[model samples]
Structure formats: structure tokens, C-alpha cells
Target: MSLEFELCLRRPFTLLAHEALLNIYYSASCLKKKAGEFLRPFGLTDVQFNLMMLLKYQSEQDEGLSQARLSSMMLVNRANITSLIDRMEKADLAIRTPAPADRRSNIVKLTGRGKELLAQIEPLYTKEVKRIMAALKLNEQKTVIEMLERIRGNVSEINENTTQDVSLVRA
Candidate 1:
């Protein structure tokens, strides 16, 4: 369906670019909400599930990941990560301990319960993801991957130019 029709807008989009941007944003928002709903029955939020997966896959050692490291990897703020860890800790899904190499910083690791939960959820999650993407053929999916990468590159360029322009104005 067209973006205007989906949005119930009386008027057309001002430009094709505007319509495309809105489509992407709307699609992303809907996907996030759907992901949240899918995980809700398992007593996990999308962010929490993402953190657990990162812990399971990204940790190179048994000691787990530093809060700083997880924040960077997740592209979220440290404070938000802290709160998420705190909630996970309360649920016994994860643990925070002083990093062996740096006592001042905390490392986040999945608890045994977390690992078990992830083990149970992963297969179902993968199946659901496949079902969701089944609307697109394999070739179409590949084309989408390429287009999204290009969009990301363009967005990065815009961000860099915006930062430079702001600094110049400040100076």
C-alpha cells in the first residue's frame, strides 16, 4: 500500500524523497513493535534479547563483556545499558561483576538461566524471522540488503557533513 494511503493522509507527499524516507521510518517502527510483541511471551524485551545475544556471541572469553564494550557494540548510551543490566540482574537473567582486568569497571555476562532461555527462544525466533522475510524472494532480499547499505552510507555522509557544518558555525 502507498504511504499516503497507509498514513491516511489527505494530500500527497511533497516529494518522492520525502515519501521514501517516511516509508523507511514507518517500516522500521512497525518492525520494532512487532519484534517486541514476538518477544513479550518469553518475558524479554528486544533490547534485553539483543544484549543477551551479544553476550552469547560476542564475548571472546568466559569473563564476558565490559559495560563500556556492550554500550559501544549496541550503539546505546552507557546509562541505558546500566539500567538494562540492572533489570536483567534483578531477573537473574544476567550478572554484573567487576572485570578481572579492571576492577573499577563492570563486566556483563549472561547467567545460566539466560543461556537456557536464549537456547529455547532462538529457534522459534529464527523461524519467525524467516516467515516474516518469506514475502521477499532470496534475490529481492539481497537487493534490499544492498540498497539499505547504500542508504546507510549516504546517511553517514550526511552526519559527517552536518557535524562539520555545525563546528564551523560555532567557530
Candidate 2:
């Protein structure tokens, strides 16, 4: 049977619920695309911007981070992280060096240029974030974040269960 038929047969409610979830995903994707366009002139993708922020945050603690750890923290594949790091390196925004403690892994360090870019972008990013959040009251924004976190937790649990079931079937 087709996937839709299977979904409907297994749990019609789930199928209906997924429509709303899909709509949220699509809408978020569109918004991200627009935000990416805005950031393009700054020579940053959303992910790259996020990485720069992460690095800046860590710098405050006097801690350096590894690319592999960053990939895991960001929930992205290593190959993608490598490519992103490569691009950033070429732009002179960051550098990759062999970790002093681990020969196998490379640490990603933000350069002076990266810090400068982050400083330049912070105000604009903050303004955009505030403008986006302005649609909701302060309390509403908190509630929305809580609700999304709950949804994410639920989805993660379901994924884990599904993976276990598939493994059982294979066994």
C-alpha cells in the first residue's frame, strides 16, 4: 500500500495531526530561506552563522571546541560539517587545527575576522529576532517555545521506538 494509505490505516488521527506538523515545517523552511537571503550579503548561511555564534559563546569560557563535537551538538552529519568548515576556512572566518589532545580530531577555531563579522551582525540579528517575536507577547513566546520543545521530545521518543521496532523485525 502507499504510505498515505498505510498511515491512515494504522492511525488516522496521526495522519491528520501530521498535516499540521508538516505545515509548521514548511512554513519554518520558508522563513529560514528568507532569513538566509538576508544573511547572504554578510557572507553567512544560517548554519554558518550559528557556528560562529557557538564559537563566540565558547570563547567567553576560554574553551575551544572540536568540529566533531560541533557536528554532534548541531545534530548534523560530519561530512556536512566538514564542508561548512571548509567554506568558512576559505572565507578566512575560521580555522581548523589538529587538536593538541587528540590527533584524530581537528578543533575549529574562530578567527579575528569571524569575531568581527559576528560583532557586525549581532545588532541586525537581534533586531530581526525581536521583530519576529513581536508578533507574540512575552508570555506567548515562552509558551510557544515550551510547546515546541514538548513536540520535539515526543517526536524523538517516537523515532526511538520506531527504530527499536525495526531492529526487532530485522532480528
Candidate 3:
């Protein structure tokens, strides 16, 4: 087994694997930077944009989303979402209203100003998304998305295992 492992290392497989990991990390960082640049004019970070979009979509159902639900949906802690909402509220982009049934919790809703800003930003956002998609052929784009989804699924599985381990340890 040791001799076989040594022979495998002599092949290009190890180098290719390292290069792939590096490429994935660099590509993700570059894309994030580009997205941040595109959103700079709107004074919105990626999380803020996600939150705003969430609220906008929720509004269509004639329902508001609670902060706890938003935090869970965003995969962030409640305190982080609370702070983000506070800043957005100060910017007049959103409002936090007490939930009718849950007085202790608040629902986040987009304000009129937020709706106007979203409208103004929609074109630029759409253009950026189009530009990203244009970089790849249809098949390549689909493959890329599928590959990313697989990676995400694997990571989630690992997280679940880790969580279970921690719970077992505590018990």
C-alpha cells in the first residue's frame, strides 16, 4: 500500500488536485470582489442584498418574515441579522415591526425607500448576472452549477455530522 501511494504521487493527479482547489478559491474570491464592486453604489453588502431580496419576495405573499426565520434562512446568527437590520433601518431601507402573534419577535419589512432603491438597482443587478452567465457556454454553465451544488451538499453533510458529534459530546 505504501509503495502504491508513492507511485500515485509520481503521477500528475496530486498536482492537478492542488491546482483545482487553488482555482476554486481564487475564482470565488474574484467573483465576490466583482459582486461587491457592482453593489457599492447601492451601499449594500451581499448579506444586506440577500435580506432585502428575501423581504421583497415575502411581501408578495402578503406576509412578513420574522428576524429568527430570516437569520436561519441566511445561515447567520440572530445577533448578526439584528445588527444588519439596525443599520438598514437607519438607512431607511427597512423597518422592523413587532410580530402580531409574537410580541417578543420582530418582522422585517422593506420600506418604500427600499422598494425604490431596489427598482433602481434591479437593472444593474440583472446586467451583472447576465455578464457572469455570458462567460460560459450553456452546457458549461449548467455543469458549473451542478458541481457547485454537489460541493454545497457535501459541505452540509459534513456540518450535520459535526453538529451531531458536538451534541453527543454535550450529552
Best by lDDT: 1
lDDT of 1 by residue, 1-54 (tens): 888998999999879988988999999998899999999999999999999999
- Say which candidate scores most in TM-score: 1
Worst 10 residues of 1 by lDDT: 56-65
Candidate models: Cα lDDT each: 0.94, 0.85, 0.84
Which is better, 2 or 3, measured by lDDT? 2
Of 1 and 2, the candidate ahead on lDDT is: 1
Please, what is the TM-score per model?
A: 0.94, 0.85, 0.81
lDDT of 2 by residue, 1-171 (tens): 343463464644356667668656765886799789879999799999989888878654636589888898778999999999999999999999998888999988888898899899999999998987798999999998898999999999999999999999999
Q: What is the C-alpha RMSD of each candidate to the true structure, in Å?
A: 1.3, 6.2, 6.7
- Candidate 3 lDDT at 48 equals 85
Misplaced by over 4 Å in model 1 are none
Q: Of models 1 and 2, which has the larger TM-score? A: 1
